[model samples]
Target: MQEVSATASLWKVALSLLVIIAFIPASLWLLKRFQLAQMKLGKTDIKILSVQSLGTKEKLMLVEVENEKVLLGVTSHTITHLKSFPKRGRPFDSELVQAQHEQVRQSQGDDK
Candidate 1:
């Protein structure tokens, strides 16, 4: 009958929709699992060393490209090069720690 045909069509639509919904997540999972989200453009030399948030939309990033390390100021709308360092120097984290310790020592000396 026509009623049976209508019910069958509805079921077919529901099944198709469910399949499409499942396909989206499955494709995403496959992409992530295989690490295919980033397109390969030969060998990449740039590496992100560290990121520090300055505010809700601003950050400081230390990045290494080739043999030089760069300090960058990043915002939602812009990226600025703050400084660059030679690869022969101490690492970024160690220098940051050393600067912090120097600040603490200076503060303690002032408190005397």
Candidate 2:
């Protein structure tokens, strides 16, 4: 009887550990599926346009707030405004494409 009780208790402990291990992955999957990791605070005017990583702990972010676009330098402890651009009539994508074309033309001219 004593041996049987000990075996049952061991089985119960093993089952509990297995359940806890399974729960971690299950909860992670649910959070990723619903994108619950990022908190949403209703609707806001500020939008992140792009992010470029500078180092392990630093990044540059382009953000649009209200009518103006801002370039920000982000570090582990601080966020600094690097520059700001005036609101333009056209979309950012068009401006980016134009800049890319200009760069290509400059490179071609240099090679020639």
Candidate 3:
């Protein structure tokens, strides 16, 4: 009858609202907890100079990210401390690399 249909619709509406309300608190709690964890774990501040993938089983990362240059730590996954950097120069420190690059260029020039 009409009464039955109206009751069913009302119940449906109530349940939907209740479920939504329940999720809001849970989502808020999860968000707050994640933010707190990140803040606690974050080691950002600078002191890292560079990094090298020394082969995967463990990565070697240079710290200070600048002129300081200190090699520190090894990891299979990610230390979060070491982070990652491409071939940015400073850390792969060596005139040898530059010399090797020049040698290659000279060879190519000779070939041309």
Where in model 2 is the C-alpha error above 4 Å? 1-7, 27-38, 92-112
Clash numbers, per candidate: 0, 0, 8
Best by TM-score: 2
What's the CA RMSD of model 2 in angstroms?
Answer: 4.8
Better of 2 and 3 by TM-score: 2
Q: Please report the TM-score between candidate 3 and the true structure.
A: 0.37
Please provide, for model 2 over 6-102, each residue's C-alpha lDDT reduced to its tens digit, 9 standing for 90 to 100.
Answer: 9999999999999999999999999886764454534678989999999999999999999789999999999999999998788879989999999
lDDT of candidate 1 over 1-112, digit per residue (tens): 9999999999999999999999999999998866744635446898788999999999999999997889999999999999998775777799899999999999999999
| Model 1, position 108: C-alpha lDDT score | 100
Worst 10 residues of 3 by lDDT: 82-91
Candidate 1 Cα deviation (angstroms), residue 103: 18
TM-score of 2: 0.56
TM-score of 1: 0.52
Clashing pairs in 1: none
Give residue 56's lDDT in candidate 1 (0 to 100): 100
TM-score of each: 0.52, 0.56, 0.37
Candidate 3 regions off by >4 Å?
A: 44-112
Ranking by lDDT: 2, 1, 3
